[model samples]
Target chain A: MMSDNSDIDKYYDVVVVGAGPAGIGVGILLQKLGINHIILEKTSIGESFRKWPIETRFISPSFTGNFFKMPDLNAITPDTSPAFTLLTEHPTGEDYVEYLENLAKYYDLPIKTEVCVDTVQKKADSFVLTTNKGEYKSTYVIWAAGEYQYPKTNAFEGTHLCTHYSEVDSFSDLEGDEHIVIGAYESGFDAMVSLIRARKVVTLLDDGDYLNLVKSDSSYSLAPFTRDRIEYVADLFDYYTETKVTSVEFVNDTYLVKTANGQTFTSPQKPINCTGFASSLTLVKESFEFKNDYPLLNDFDESTKTSNLFLVGPQVKHKNALFCFIYKYRQRFAIVAEKIAKRMKVPSQAIEKAIQGYKDNNFYLTDLSCCDDECTC
Target chain B: MMSDNSDIDKYYDVVVVGAGPAGIGVGILLQKLGINHIILEKTSIGESFRKWPIETRFISPSFTGNFFKMPDLNAITPDTSPAFTLLTEHPTGEDYVEYLENLAKYYDLPIKTEVCVDTVQKKADSFVLTTNKGEYKSTYVIWAAGEYQYPKTNAFEGTHLCTHYSEVDSFSDLEGDEHIVIGAYESGFDAMVSLIRARKVVTLLDDGDYLNLVKSDSSYSLAPFTRDRIEYVADLFDYYTETKVTSVEFVNDTYLVKTANGQTFTSPQKPINCTGFASSLTLVKESFEFKNDYPLLNDFDESTKTSNLFLVGPQVKHKNALFCFIYKYRQRFAIVAEKIAKRMKVPSQAIEKAIQGYKDNNFYLTDLSCCDDECTC
Candidate 1:
């Protein structure tokens, strides 16, 4: 439900920024709790998902096993499955956006689109969010502006000479016969595969041997979907491990890519940078204390420095656990909503009933100890 | 560990037949409960998995989210993941065998391969299983022999003229370029896709419109993985829905497949029948009362007519819930084990502690009500 700037309330018990999976997820919880809340999206629901490269598919496969208490990995809520809705295992960016939009409509979540929150400031008792449309105040603020839109473009010297992976509308539309892809992670391999499939030769430079490094956690390792895609095209690409790209130099319509290993490669077109994304937390850096570039979060995911100000989405980190993926970060949605609702003096029984489904499924993860264990087999 | 036939005990509390996922899964639970039991297999471990067609991959995808309480869908045990062990999402039959072998070795399960149970006769208080090696007696008999190896060859008239879907070693190795595949379920679609990819012309005769039928339960519908595989090859072949094959006839070195709709398709080679399989429960049909060809069982999946006789694996059905997939039936492992362990008077705490991980990780599903809800979006 899109509300006009004038129609939106000036104040709410909770205000969620961004209409991505994290924002929509937590907003559903708050709505269920009967808490006054609004989700403000800079663009529209699932804007980041809609902006994904055309060839890019979700590395994590989706399956409808929600009835067995195992929700689809890509589902925002336990009751919905992307696979069932989209009828595809690896939903495209557009397909996922449809899922998010469906959720927003089904839940009748109060959302205001095209309202960009430029800055957030804490007053004596409330958070004042200054948006492009107008000012809004909330007792609790959930910063769910995800990381995908904020690409890490300034990673190396002369990085602007290259195209970031996120900016590509489609790999097949690239004007070059050959391309040099920097950073050999999920996005890197994805770009390389798409290029190769488009009948182009590609070179991949990796800072680490991600292909050989297998971790028990899907969060740390290359997903099986990526591995499967790369397996068929492994012989078609030039892959250099431990060769971190230093910079790209454009000379005479040629791009010379230099690496940390003192090796240089030439490409006719601008090299593609797949060095990953910067956290959206950069926007609200002053609200939370920093530890190793991650915002400090308490047990309830509230900011350590600012009271009632919370962090959701991929930026949420507790110890070694990186809540980056939808499955990982989604677990914290209820915890954030519950804390805000409880503090608002919502009835205890109502809160319990509202969050019971999340608790029953793996959505509400409070115990961080289980996140670090390696698979025995 | 493989036990010698000479060292096998003549008497036990439980004797689990077949060393596939069902038997092995239940055996682990029984061992954890400190119950005296032995799992007997006619062949080596994962014999059914080993027998799958060379090009066939698991319809259900596997991901290692075990730490977050979501175990791999194909994993028999809660702690183990096929994706982690095999490092693939849709593991081939051979790859899956490796995972099953690893689980068997890791748990040090009491497995006696090459010992086929010929006859299971109830002898007053105990059930006597007469095997190829010798006679063994047990208070409880868990018939976990899966249905894959048991192909339904007599589904139609003159079906012997055609090759059953289970009999094909590889679709690429088939004798002719043109083939007729009967029954358009998972196996039928798999055969068609593999043959088409191998540069063959194929015609499919489906008994029902499975492609158009969408069910909330994965067991009742084609999996997303199957849908993805067929998406690329959908236009390459002729798919005849609501066309049931009635008979196959051999005439002048050519085979003719007759359908119920008065359609006759000709092929140089024998037609492929993928009508599906009869339950392995056929072996001990007299022990259990039958309803709609499914063995009638109580809440514990025990044969209603017989005492101390239980059922496990894909053959298990409760109302509309068809527990045919590994993820579906594995939930009953703990329930069956707990009941048998309790009857043997094992300590409640030990059983509880042993099955705690299963309960927490969705390995134990006692509530069947959740199995029927449809996805909202």
Candidate 2:
């Protein structure tokens, strides 16, 4: 029943890193399971969502579908919906932060904010987490630090010369008449729409024709929200599809955006990189194996190399099913919690009840193969 | 696999009236269940959706939540997502109509457009549907003719003097300097937002403080989307809470709106009524027994008074659960299909397979009690 870190023992049963949806989801379950765990947050809960561009909103819409076994698309837990809490469908960053804060308060989850985890080292039977606040010891560690903080700096050369889309507070604040935006994903299109709305001329460079692609998975396709926004501002921007940006260079107060097609564009503003994000697993790179720059996890989301160590959040991938969306990854919260609980020998009846609840609510998914089918209708 | 009514049999297992989500959904199941049935549309598939105000969008957010048993909120079927098909989170009426058209084509569900049902009478266990196009004989009938076409005109006196919100094709087209909007629900808020955006001075009268009311059920409260829109335009409108308009009188040029609170408001533009819609069930009132204005139905959604006649769509309420949203009413599609398929004596194996498919996807809800609980989080 306790969520606040009070009257605590020196050692904890588990320590979940990051207080975003993934960590909060795991922390909520662990608390419900009567497992003593402390959530270590580097900044605050939903900090990633808070850092989203000023005009940024969740492409996934939120509805109070909880009673119908469909947890709100953006909700981390089963009983909550950001739409109901924030009164918004596509919640802005601040709105989402409010939802996360409310969830944390409701569950009384033990989250220690402004406590940065510097490193994790396995010592004997327990893992030691050295944070800026203090050292923490736990039997199991759930790494849910997420990928927003770690932009893909190494994805392209001279990435530092350009501003990452995440760095821009608001497109309206950009001090330029003409801007050259590199990348055509959601963020890229978002930047385009906002800039156009603010009356700024933009040259949007796309690596691929992402606008026309309609893949079964939303991860591969531009979200419907983004598509609708693009449609509203498409005529206002100079779009170059099937063109990839290789690098950017500053020359005489202008960014020279070079592309894979051997073309270059000059912009008064630094070229924005909407390329994507790098896995925060670099924090514990040597501990687990990586494939395609992502952590390799077993069916239970447990690290392939590190036993009792679990991974959650947007970076999670099994073959092709990107557990990036809340609805997709929320399923694993129960599975991972069950695995950790079983390892700790938590009561069988409690485990069954909790897991069954998750299963009955459609919040538990064990199979990944079924996630590949396209909509027949 | 055929959709057009050209090759239809002289007698059908069931005849579904309306080609919107409800009827199209049931028709898809009937086609899959191997039952000979056809969907009759007064105009075309999703015509009501197409007829919605140009500024209107679905309050529900659409996500491809099918794998987790939560299909897109606006999807007619389990596998489809309006967000994925139309590429928009809150699709406009036109966008939704396109989605319905695509689904009908994909499923090849027999749908005859412009075939308006003038009268439906049951005779000796067979329902004879007399439409403008022709007469059809069916063993069972499903009335999916939604409520959009039947706006509640009798709720207030002098309603015809005021423009029902549904009558306005687009708020931008309204030629007005000042306007008085009646009702403060989703449509009222929507009209206010659109008119405000178009630079009109609006006076929105609310019978209650509906803006502050946050009910767990979306039916009672203003939609999250509407809330977000109101947040952006709240300052633009002159809001009058606890004001119920008893009547509207056009005195010469201006509209003098009379309220129960004894406050009168003058607007150059006619007041827009957002009081809500009347159930289309009154068209066949002699058949189904009514409870609190809604049709009383069995678990199967078949009429309590009329045998072999089914009811689907927003009007099909069971206790407190208003099956108004596609997600709610869609559950009964399989149940009704199974019941009719059983009576038609389609093999038990076929019925079981189809019904089990619905159950597995979380689309079949026989129990309404589970939907009453609010999210504790």
Candidate 3:
């Protein structure tokens, strides 16, 4: 329905790129702030979540405690819950897409789907976005395009020989009795667990002991959801820690996964590359200065080099605090909105009321230093 | 290890006669207030949770977001989460039991297991309890005995002809291929979903059309977690709505289920009774005033008939509010603790601090009227 719309080439106060949770989140706040904004998407709303592996689920759990002040952790808005909308806790990609689509419809945010933004360039006082649809001019741009859809292809040589974890629709759809899984992060463990459940023999290669490392903060350790599955399937598969896969090659209908320690494993099919995803900022690398592979942002999450240009997704980080999860990054949506609203001169009373709503629910985390506390138990 | 304690024979200020999440929750607050309390469990701590059907999981989702004032809904304490402790959102009965056990140990709660309290007699400003192990005396009694273990047998005649949902360890352990499930609540739908997952044809008999009814409060409606699974399995099973089971008869090696509307279903195996659980207040029916099979309590959850006797579990219903969930029942734990502390003459500063913690996290829900609002979208 959105593909037929010719509104992609328009002028707006802010143009939010990508229609995932992050994009829709900012759009909702933008709507509340009464900002004339439009969300541009390459496909449809939450296309990345729709493209997630069918068996993959959010590590975060959601509960319908919106009225009680405990909104769903994965919810972009305060009153919504993926658990309530999709009726599941650990929502699959499709479940999440439904949630995003519902949020977009509920708020009636202006979003143009199937409009890909190929380039973003700051010209004078506006960001001239060059897209397949046309050139879009906006006073400010919120780069909310998430990272899950963009797989890290350059992690190893001959990477095309293996099936990226993000590419597989479902593990059940794969026709293989024995397979090799490269990388031992959450995705790697997820694929291994899925394969093990389907009565398949798996060999997992890990560069570190992520399974044994237990950290109170989710940013540093394996999620409890992954830990639970690993406990059940740990012994079912062969695991080699400290073994990093350096390259992969397909020869004679067999894929050879070569590791850094001069070890090679053979799989009947292509090895699953669960090495995780790359930053979506790779599309606009010239806009912001990189601080250790992460964007340099001000307190408002706007690019330091390019003022009025903001980033509101998982690629955001401040020192040691990793704002990669939905719960963490969703905090900045209100903050980013407030900053833009203040600059746009939206009434101070309205801005304060809108921002306070987020703060009241403990969703606004301005201080990143306090998040590193270890569990007392 | 607490079974070896000789303190079982001693007197106490409060005897919380249950070591599940409720008892542990009250115990933690009591410990903080320096109150003298001992948790008495009929079996081990969280035995009811341990007895739940293995395939059945918590309808509430658990997330570890305690520091930011959004504690896990399933957590008894502020800092703990079933997700972090058990590593799952919808933890199975065993997983929940482990979380409860961990809470008991972490807080060093004084709990006596395998000591069933048979009867209670108020004697001279004190309650004398006759247990299987010994007689115990206490000034106050908190009945934290949960309801899941006690299945309602007399809901229909010949109920013994069916298998209670809680009796089976897991659905996979069920030997029969064809089964008739009586009662279509959460437990009934849970059995149906599990049976369908296991490729077994199931016939679920419900007294009402609970599937289509959507309520804002989870206590009155089917949880989103259950709803999600029901969506996938609703078509797979034969669901008979508004069909109340009147009797179950076993003849010719076939179990026959008779409903109120002259409908009878037969299964080769015994019918599984998913007819929910009964309150554990049967032991103290003489203590509280009953209003249509419900206990009447004061503002502090103390019995109106007996001043010192209090209720702090799922059975505590007030007006239109049903405190049947961990999040709801957990709110009143502090209220009960505060009332008990004031009576025990504990330091007001300590009591206020202990209770304030619950309120700070929005765990102290003093008003029940606000819970009735349905979702607009």
Q: Which candidate has the highest lDDT of all?
A: 1
Across all models, the iRMS values in order are 0.9, 1.6, 2.5
What TM-score goes with each of the models? 0.98, 0.94, 0.87
Displacement of the residue A47 alpha carbon in candidate 1, Å: 1.1
lDDT tens per residue, model 3, A1-377: 24565675568899999898899988899998899998999988888888877888888776666655667778887767777677666889888888888778878888888888899999999899998888989999999999988889988998888889989888978988998998988889999998888899999999887788766667777776688778877679999999988889888888888888999999879899989899999898899999899999998899999999999888999877778888888888998999999899999999877777687665787776666665543
Q: Is candidate 1 or candidate 3 better by TM-score?
A: 1
Using Cα atoms, each model's DockQ against the true complex is 0.80, 0.59, 0.29
lDDT of 2 by residue, A141-254 (tens): 999999988887865678998888888888899887888887888888888888899999999999888899987687788877788788888688999998888878888988
Candidate 3 clashing pairs, residues 3+ apart or interchain: none
**lDDT tens per residue, model 2, B181-227:** 99888888888898898898889899999999987788777777788
lDDT of 3 by residue, B254-340 (tens): 888999999889889989988878778999989999897789999899999999999998998888777888988898888899899
TM-score, first chain, each model: 0.98, 0.96, 0.97
Candidate 2 interface RMSD value:
1.6
lDDT of 1 by residue, A104-200 (tens): 9999999999999899999999999988888889888999999999889777888889899989999999997999999988999999999999999
